[model samples]
Target chain A: MKQDSCQVTVIDRKRIELARKQMPGAEVLENVSEVLKLLGDTTRLRILLALATTELCVCDLAALLEMTSSAISHQLRLLRARGIVKYRKEGKIVYYSLDDPQVQSLIKVSMDQIG
Target chain B: MKQDSCQVTVIDRKRIELARKQMPGAEVLENVSEVLKLLGDTTRLRILLALATTELCVCDLAALLEMTSSAISHQLRLLRARGIVKYRKEGKIVYYSLDDPQVQSLIKVSMDQIG
Candidate 1:
């Protein structure tokens, strides 16, 4: 395919360099990638959106999104492993919520932009 | 597998609800998911970071990242299709850069948090 030539004004070039310089550490890239990967999936995104509204157990999440509990469990496991979500035990039930405030804020900002 | 119980404090509940409400449009979710999915890959993420610093054509991007031109081309195609990156043609070379300021800002903020 024919590619178009792009021009980089001095200002944008400086901005890009600043962005790269400001990027977090190697470990942070991994974590951010993990978080982004988790958010990449539609099912997972919806699950997160639902959870963003309320702390729900696997079953409740499944019910709200009309997905299977097994699927929700699998996605939740991914999110939990990435530290994007945390869970607590109440008897035999497991309720889950955002692991960090940053996660909520990131989602909020993205939502605000898109909304 | 046994799941852990999670507790939802009122504050968190309110925050989550607010996040859900604030999330952009269904279209933005699709777009965000597209962008995130593109960034989810290590190769693509590295490419974006590199491009985030400078406007580079396929050749420069491939050379800087030490990847094949073919690979860079493919990834750039995805970025361009999603409006994450735009390119202009100058002779036989095509230069690519970020399509929107939001992308740069988002990357910067994420890097800041993790850094």
Candidate 2:
């Protein structure tokens, strides 16, 4: 009742303050959430997992995922937009890899945890 | 033309084989995606971030996030089902924290990557 009635209900100020102080800024939190959300997709995640191990051209990714190069390229475009994956152009081939080293850690850590 | 007409178009067999070899099993990838999906929500992620720093009860989380205990409990249930966070009952209070160490790493690694 008190909690409902009160404009401000402080259950544990220490925790409130602690969580507040340690909380990453709003932008960072938003970016982190966005990154996680983007990583949440199955096909995209599969591509990332593959790239985490080594660089892959669209055709290679398509072969590995049993999909088409066009399909793989579409998802890779989304990943590239989010800055999660980057590509290198060598002649007519474009190879993609995880843009951030910490991304590999994120995947490895999450996979290890799941295992 | 060659790629489209053929059911199997091998761009670079070596890269595909390497990716397939390094790819995690299907279940692990699914679970990892599920975990990341669970973590993709803002409220759930905020709760996890708080717990990553220290343990907190539903009341504490609600108060800190400025939400009702019932709302906090609902999200906590989802998080619990996914095993991203765990809780212990003490008296009338239930304290929650991240279930897996690598979850902390996942968050930390992502945050670092974003930075």
Candidate 3:
């Protein structure tokens, strides 16, 4: 029984080591978690989904979302900090769009799969 | 000036409507947010990442993660509720594995893009 248990322990250890190796980033997992967390909010996810299709300014997003510009701005800040969205200013308007194509692809694929 | 302002308002309303139409699930968005929120934690994300590679029992995951089995069990419960992971009981052990192929694919794509 002791010998059998030792062998099982060794196998478990090996399996874990293999999992760690395949995962690659113990460091970036937090960043990934944060990004996923940001997407976890329905409003934020909808905002990202909208932005993925085209660039839009705060006022437009607010009008479309039926939300205040302040709410839209706050969500955009979170998305921007994670490098998920990018924006450019023109006069008094700031236009926001997805910074990474992967993000857009992710949103598209997830939405399709879910539907 | 009134005519010009009306044109701008119409354009803004049109843009908002377009955003709403493109994103189909105002209903399921909440569920998606919940799933994403569940995946938002580093430990849970790691647990999912580890499970993505192979089927692992709670004890093995705890050992590998250097966390308590209780903690691993809690995380697994969330993942299971989200339908992200599935398990089967055999004798005294319950083996857990990724339930959805799309989930595995998403993880692979995201990891690759990040790296």
lDDT of 3 by residue, B1-115 (tens): 1123222322355566677788766677876677768767889888888887788888787776767778889888888887889999988788899997776676666566553
What is the DockQ of the complex in model 1? 0.20
DockQ of each candidate, alpha-carbon based: 0.20, 0.52, 0.40
Q: Write candidate 2's Cα lDDT for A8-56 as tens digits.
A: 3555668768987888877878878877887888899999989877888
- In model 2, state the lDDT of residue A106: 75
Highest TM-score against the true fold, candidate: 3
> Chain A TM-score for each candidate, in the given order?
0.73, 0.77, 0.77
Q: Candidate 1: where are CA atoms >4 Å away?
A: A1-26, B1-26
Q: What is the Cα-based lDDT of residue A39 in candidate 1?
A: 75
The DockQ leader among the candidates is 2
Docking class of 2: medium
Interface RMSD of each: 8.4, 3.3, 5.1
Residue pairs with clashing backbones, model 3: none
